[model samples]
Target: MSTAASTEACSTSRRMSIGMLYVDLGIVTRPQLFEALVECARTRCTLPAALASLGYL
Candidate 1:
């Protein structure tokens, strides 16, 4: 892959890992994580910020 594509892939993988970690640790439910992801995309915010906004953080 191109350098930019590789970097983007790595970033996406890392973000997915973090979200899964939260679920694994019982910090958030899978559905909550899904909602946070949607909020993250809609608000252009990070996952943590989205979680906090959703009163999960």
Candidate 2:
């Protein structure tokens, strides 16, 4: 893979890791987190922003 592709993959995983951390910590349910992820994709928003919009944070 190219350097840019590798970097993008790493960044995407890090975002997912953060979301999982929140789930594991009981801050949000898996469904809620998945909802936020979907909203984030649709809105092109950050995960934190999506979580906030979903009232998870």
Candidate 3:
């Protein structure tokens, strides 16, 4: 893989881990995580910021 691809993969993996951490900690459900992800994408914000905007945090 190219260096760019490898970096992208690592970034994606890290993002998923953070999402799962929220679920594992009981801070959010899987569905809620999905919602937060959507919100994050929509607003181009971080997960924690998205959660805060959605009143989860």
Candidate 4:
């Protein structure tokens, strides 16, 4: 794969990892994490910013 593709994949995985960690910690529900993920995809923002936008952060 191209370097850009590899980097993007890495970042995406890292984002999901952080989200799941929050879920495991009971800081946010799975549904809330999914919502933030969707918003992150839509807004092209960072996961933390998306969580904040959804009031999960």
Segments of candidate 3 deviating more than 4 angstroms: 1-12
Report clash pairs, candidate 1: none
- Highest-lDDT candidate: 4
Report the number of the highest-TM-score candidate: 4
Candidate order by lDDT, decreasing, is 4, 1, 2, 3
Q: What's the TM-score of each model vs. the native?
A: 0.76, 0.76, 0.74, 0.84
Q: List candidate 2 stretches off by more than 4 Å.
A: 1-10
What is the number of backbone collisions in each predicted candidate, taken in the order shown?
0, 0, 0, 0
- lDDT tens readout by residue for model 1, 1-57: 899889766765776789999999999999999998888768867889899999999
Task: Compose the digit string of candidate 4's lDDT tens values, residues 4-57.
Answer: 899878888888999999999998999999999888878889998999988888
RMSD to the true structure for each prediction, in A, is: 2.1, 2.0, 2.2, 1.2
Off by over 4 Å in 4: none
Between candidates 3 and 4, the TM-score winner = 4
Q: How high is the CA lDDT of each candidate model?
A: 0.87, 0.86, 0.83, 0.90
- Residue-wise C-alpha lDDT for candidate 3, range 1-57, written one tens digit per residue: 999889766765776789999999999998888898888767767888888898888
